[model samples]
Target: MKYFRANRPLTINEVQKFAPAAFADKASLDVSKNYSFLSTRNLIETLEKKNIVPFAVAQTKSRTDEAKESGRHLIRFRHENHKLEIGEVVPEIVLETSHDAKSSFKFSLGLFRLICENGLVAPCSILDTIRIKHVKADDSDVIDAAFEVLDSSDSAIENILEMKRKVLSIDDRFSFANEATTLRWEKESDCPHLPLEKILAPRRRKESELDLWTTFNVVQENLVRGGLSFYKLNDKGYPIARQSTRAVNSIAKNLELNRNLWTLANKFLNN
Candidate 1:
């Protein structure tokens, strides 16, 4: 995906005109009544007025050959520091298809962690998200709702920082690995489960830092990106070495892993 830094807010028409290839496929005239289009241009203007400058935009289609209505655009903003680190805030506005009704449009919030650049959807438990049902809301309402969430990012940053400050012991790390393994392989009876030792293996020497933040990333990398090894039967009926694939491939899985991992880490602090 090509990302362009926005110096000023651009309207949907301007975005389409500027990047015809990305937004070339226009929505059909009969697009679903439930779907409503948010004013990207107005959103940008609102963000800029609040000193929230958009730094990047990504356009993607839900599937190949799908109409433009199925396409989504991601707008990203750096909360304060451009540097990536734990507790640093990166907010993203996703304009995409609505779940309430097919053929309608909605905008959702996503967050990015600097440590691993992991993108997290804003959990309803944490952040207030705006859902604009075309039937009930107008463009101004969408803009107002989006600003409400963006303005409350300070609280979100505080939550992230609190998590980062809590340290994890060596035993806690191992326990986390075991719990993560259970979460990853609870359904796969045929697959050989990875051992806790292997899950705790560090990809880099620096990753051995004894903290909940680093430990979570180390284990998460191994589970989601696949760096560990396991055995499988070959055609000759002999055990052969096989590399593990991503444990979480879909968005739902990603969200589950992130939420569960954080919840697990939070337990240590609570205790």
Candidate 2:
């Protein structure tokens, strides 16, 4: 619940100090120099306005306290200059149809990390989740691999590998997210070649185009009319099922991990 923003470049140790649950392999790489936290609420709102459906796992206050009190579940995300860092949350990755296996999904929701302080979410490419050590954000470069495009006819593995090489060669920065893996990109080099800039940039302008009042009204109507269902994880890390007619709750359910943590942090800070 405590939203942590980086006042300065955060070392792994520093992040661990605030949220001990952060990934384990903090020693190998200097993640402290990069990445920041983001408000999950603001992040989801931004995504929804852009019409991007991001699938995420919900954590409650229990998880929140576990992270803040002992830094046991801390995860980090790296981003550039506070742009929309977390990529499109892939909804296809289903961990379970039932509730018991939810934690599996929690770990699979891409490696995107939230910078608690400024609400700046970033890719958690460089940090190792199990060992919690830092690795090359772009292992595609170091490891020489290819990524499978969600849907592409010409997207062969070889092509993906080549693209990966080129991207990592340029943008040395690595991004981490939820899915036990890393995504590497070389910004300047990759963008011009494939319009990555246009594709990657968050539709910030598109969000601004919508009149806030109108958007909220529409969202409100959907909440009121729609059969809304969600799993509300409280500070104790317990799932609470309820119905709501609030767009905000939708945002909360979608990006619940960040929301629950942020909620707990706010509660702790206020109390």
Candidate 3:
């Protein structure tokens, strides 16, 4: 997938370069006659009226010509009320849909930390998932649903606070990182084992904390922006040449990994 992200809201032209699907006026020819065309641009305009503006947008690289303009795309926006202060967790609205009839207008809550690089803070708790089936675009519903997703911030914040309050010992922190590696590569026995230390180290001094929140952020950023090196032994027990993990950009894979990481964090929180 190709994506554009920033601390400030992205302009339509900027978003268009990454996700032309957002501007498509008609549904894909593959859709049935009953399928109604709902433009993502209309929904974005509707939400912007309520001060919910897009900060990041992305789409899959389409292979077929017909799917080029109707492929799945995602827009991540934040409410005007949320402060974009560095090192603080902020709430956001994640919206995804496509005109190919393969996706519906789905809305979910997200959290982000405004560090120098603008790392995403995965949703810590179970948040509402709003799905709108094929229908003519309506502003009122978009506005209401956006606010409803934003309302989930309270629970998200609470979860973050709890994670911060519970401090972890060095060994515990490494354990968390170890589990994160498994989440990234399920059935590690079948894959080259990633070193826990690579993901455990924080990029900034401020992020080096023995708490769940900070630890989660460190691991999440490393796993998502992967360049970690690990060696795997081949059939004869001879080590294969060093290989680096690739950054995850597939929409489905990224979402699944993030949610899995979130679930792993919660399990540690409760124990």
Name the best candidate (by lDDT).
3
Q: Clash totals for all models, in order?
A: 3, 59, 0
**Candidate 2 residues 122-163, lDDT tens each?**
112211111111222322221111111112213222322232
Q: Of models 2 and 3, which has the larger TM-score? A: 3
Tell me which residue pairs clash in candidate 3.
Answer: none
The models' CA-based lDDT, in order, is 0.57, 0.25, 0.80
Better of 1 and 2 by TM-score: 1
**What is the TM-score of each predicted model, taking all chains together?**
0.66, 0.24, 0.90
**Model 1 segments beyond 4 Å from truth?**
1-31, 40-45, 48-69, 79-116, 120-125, 128-130, 181-186, 190-192, 233-238, 247-256
At residue 24, what lDDT does model 1 achieve? 32
- Expressed as tens digits, the lDDT of each residue in 1-271 for candidate 1 is 3444443444556555433323433344556765555455555666667666455455543544453433445455444334555645576554333222342444445566555555555545465445566575566886676666666666656666666787877788888888777666666664464678788887777667777766766777677766577767676867777756554544335545655665665566466
RMSD of each: 5.3, 20.1, 2.3
Candidate 3, residues 1-271: lDDT per residue as tens digits?
7458887788889988888899898889879887777778887787778888888898998998678799999888887666666677788888778999898887778777778454353553667477777866454566577778888888888888998998988888888888887778788574566667888988889988889988988898888887878887788878888888888888767776787888888889899
The weakest ten consecutive residues by lDDT in model 2 span 174-183
The candidate that achieves the highest TM-score relative to the unseen native structure: 3
TM-score of 3: 0.90
RMSD value for candidate 3: 2.3
